[model samples]
Target: MITLKNVNVNELESAAQSCDFILPIEQTAVWASYQATIEGRKPWGCFIIQQDEKPLAFISLIDFETHGYHYVRSMHGPAWLEHPTQELETQVLQALATQLKQADKNLVFMRVDTWYDNLAVPVLSTVPYNQTVIISLEGGYEEILKRMKTRGRRDVRKAMRECPATCMDETERAYNDFSEYYEVMVDTGKRDGFVPAPLSDYTDMLGALGKDHCRVFAARVDERVVGWSIITMHGPVAVRYYAAMRSDAMHMFVTDRLLYAECCMLYDLGVTHYDLMGIGNDFAPSLKGLNVFKTKFSTEIIPVAAGRDIPLRPVYYKALTTAKKLRKVLKH
Candidate 1:
């Protein structure tokens, strides 16, 4: 049997504290780091899955208002074993659809951005489609880097030679550089036709990470800033969460050296695997330069298989996605 209910802050926090996979985004640690911490108040929940009343898994989703519509963020979970039967996933999602409807009878639609593959269930009539990335982190970072093309290695070395960079864990004031990083991200997003996450999101992450759970690594050119990346550590995995470079100097490979340093620090921190995050595969699926940038420092590209979206109300899901596309257009 499956059940979903909006629990209180204490219960929500307890379930997260007990999670086994240590999902970097979904874990309790991140909520504090980014200051996006949630309680049973407003639109937040700890949806539980069980077997004979024994909790088998939990999905930590943040129910918040975005652009005036209800959205759910998968901080982590549907946490499960290596492989669960198709029937099991169906039950999980059905429970979710029921819960989402209960929470927001007035809520038009709810969106979940999960970075996990195969966790999606066709039984979920509430989701239209999932958009996100899930990179595998099952090996040592250096060995993965070695698998990159010869050109990738050269850029890594070139970035090292050209930039005077210093990489380390984040400090209280590290977010000051978050601005420089965000600027370049905005520029990149515009070029690619997407908007970047707001500054509040970074601060929320920092507050959630506090000083102990996450680290921000940066690259500087002669006391002038060039590039930066954020990594969150949970269990044995280190996720390359976010990164950016100075628009003018990106061609100089500062981003490469910055990543190399991040890998080294992860090794020092005793992490076994690193997540390269996301890469798009369409039209220019094998986009030479961007692919070269990430693969050079890592070889493993975990195929995210395919995504599954469940829509509780098929009609609403269609309208929501359409409205979303139109909204993006009006913003620009």
Candidate 2:
């Protein structure tokens, strides 16, 4: 049953708003359109799933090809309007599987990173994510500070006293000019032992989203850039996507001030939630430091369902899983 028929990217507002887990920026059409603008990759599509003429789910797929086989990745979605029963979810997954198989004989697998917790259909594999942190910006600035950890509040006070934070000009030049911020991001990635995105990628992302949807905040100590962040404000939520700080500025608490300033900025613009992005599941060692920093100001931790891979071609799926295991061993 095509409960929802031929729902295009432009027609995603109603579907996206129906689901609590699906943020406005995370709408299938928005991401698929952005991906298409990029140079590489395969065909992609955006669709909405409905029940009883009411939108229930939204998914965007990228038909990636490798070794003569095609696999679909539903980016951060198949987000639901509400908690789905196991039977309902299974039927939806099966319907999707049948549809993809008939559309492309070479299709081997469909991978989904479901949002929220539900009994999704069993899959070949799962990708885990740490619980995420979010802060409600509804109570206004003073109420926001009142919810922060005592130490966090103290640091913010110190940061204000020592080094103030400010948003750069909300102009196209600041958004496109990645020269200064890119350097800090590289240094931060090396210090944190993670790879940073290339300058071209940021340029492309800002260009696609435009200055109205994205903004950059910078912290300074006596005219020197100490910390910076790139945030996206879409729908009702604002996410601090990329952030970096100078190693020397850590003790100065520049990062704290930068984050607080951004929250205020978003609040002024009527955004109600601030997502600190990904964090450890339970203060795990891997992200202990990062988690500690975000937890200080977070209202709660939200655990979203991770990615799962379902096989359309069982034999090829086995081979792919085997290769993945082998690669992991080789890396070790």
Q: Please report the candidate that would top TM-score against the real structure.
A: 2
TM-score of each: 0.73, 0.85
**Model 2 — which ten-residue stretch has the worst lDDT?**
115-124
Off by over 4 Å in 2: 1-4, 14-23, 65-69, 115-130, 164-173, 282-289
lDDT of 2: 0.70
lDDT of 2 at 92: 77
Residue-wise C-alpha lDDT for candidate 2, range 1-332, written one tens digit per residue: 43534566656656565454554475545556555666545435667787776677777677766566777877556767676776777777777877877777777888876542343334544334537788888888887788777877777777778765554533354575778778888888888888987888777777777776777778766666667877877777888877889887777777777888887878888889898877765523355566878988865677765566778888888887788789899999
Q: For all the candidates, what are their Cα RMSDs to the real structure?
A: 5.2, 3.4
Candidate 1: list runs displaced more than 4 Å.
3-20, 29-43, 113-151, 161-172, 175-198, 282-289, 305-309, 322-332
How far residue 154's Cα lies from its native spot in candidate 1, in Å, is 4.4
TM-score of 1: 0.73
- lDDT by residue (239-302, candidate 1, tens digit) is 7777776667667667777777777777777777677755645522433335645655544566
